[model samples]
Target: MVRGVVRPHRVLSGSWGEVIASNLDYHRATFRWKCEGLSEAQLRRRAVPPSELTLLGLMRHLQGVERHWLQRTLAGTTPAFPPYKTYVTAAGDEWYDDSDPTPAREVYEDYVRACQESREVFARATADTARIVPNTEFGATDVRFVLEHVIEEYARHVGHADLLREAIDGSTGE
Candidate 1:
């Protein structure tokens, strides 16, 4: 498990925003906990057969996901930073493989930074009923929906990450 990842206390009773935000942060920390203390090779190793999944790959994937939702969708603007073309797969998955030569440290740092930026965005956001992507082809959705969707996304991928981490070092935990 990763050090310095403090999962926020569960909000048994609070505003809707508070509860969902806490859950999202919990899943985020769990993802990081699953990737702690691993070397570049260990992070990139394809532990599960017939799967391209890797810890570093997940980190990169989540980084894109965070940006896609909060930075693009929520902020409703293009990203100011350089894109992540070099990290994604040819099939458009936000992952890497044996051919990807990026250092593990960069991937990990990018994820942490993205998570922080997401938190900032969430903090500054308006009420849950506020419509996102108003009048767009994506249809109307609210902040609550997007936040919950991101939480669901994190939970699903964290499960994948849990399996990958276990296969990598034979270690496992919540």
Candidate 2:
């Protein structure tokens, strides 16, 4: 789905890069598996009443996350996001806020592209080097640290996807 990284499991040129890349691939596949075989309506169907997480919404939010982390941060862009004030909207502001919004397709497209681009970025980042990263709830370090963060994020979401998928349809597992 992404343009930068293809199969995250394929070994690249470096040992560390290969390990991180593999995790990336693993999460991408896991994410796809969680999202498999559902129509647009099914993807957008909410798991519980008054809750803000539909699979479609989750997908949108994932795209937003990629855009922020890779396209914005990794790419070293100054502005973190668009100038729209609605970026502060609680629910669909970042992900699937709109009920049946037309731009959902666009968000998914951007999401995939961002993932691929991040893969390329990581390759170019000289995975052999070190850098400083901010302190997160998960602790802090640099690029390697961030990659670990990315993997954890994807893993957590994949689990969420599993439960959500089960609720959406009786289907489960890879």
Candidate 3:
């Protein structure tokens, strides 16, 4: 089982950035917890039939999500890793492939790094309001929207990870 990562306590009263960061970190840790103790094969196993989702894929996807929202969207910086969408299958329905040969350990490590980078970006920001993206489908947007969207993305995927993990080995928890 994985160790060393701990979910942070809920911030009942704090600055807006502090509360959002805490919730985001909590969900990120939850996703990692769901995949803990699994072997590479287990991590790659398509536990959810008819769906290409795997623990390793989720790790890759979340890593991209964290970087995309914080580094690209919020900070307008180029992504430091491969775009997760580039791996779209011939079927064009999934971002991850069951046949991918990348080591699961590498995927996990990259995910951790992405999370750290996102946290650093957030911590360094002077204000979320001034960092705005213009002319989006959602119109002008700022880090507030980006942070909320990223947290929502994690919350949804963590639930998926919970189901997939339970299917893999009958394991279940928050």
Compared with the true structure, all predictions reach lDDT values of 0.75, 0.62, 0.78
Cα error, residue 29 of model 2, in Å, equals 1.8
Give the least accurate 10-residue stretch of model 1, judged by summed lDDT. Answer: 79-88
lDDT over C-alpha atoms for residue 2 of model 3: 73
Residue-level lDDT for 134 in candidate 2: 45
Q: Model 2 over residues 1-174: C-alpha lDDT tens digits?
A: 232333345555568877677777778767766776667777777776676677766776665566555444444543233222123354533334546465545555656676776676666653444765444344445666666667777877888788888888887774
The parts of candidate 1 lying over 4 Å away from their true place are: 1-4, 80-98, 134-139
In angstroms, give how far residue 48 of model 3 lies from its true place.
Answer: 1.7
Ranking by TM-score: 3, 1, 2
**Considering TM-score, which of the candidate structures 1 and 2 is the better prediction for this target?**
1
Shift of residue 152 alpha carbon in model 1, Å: 1.4
lDDT winner: 3
* Candidate 2: stretches off by over 4 Å: 1-14, 75-100, 126-129, 134-140
True-vs-predicted CA distance for residue 69, candidate 1, Å: 0.6
Tens digits of lDDT, candidate 1, 1-174: 246666778787898777877887888888988888888888888899898788887887788778887777776646544244455557764444445666777777778888888787776663544665552424678776777667878988999998999998898888
lDDT, residue 24, candidate 3: 83
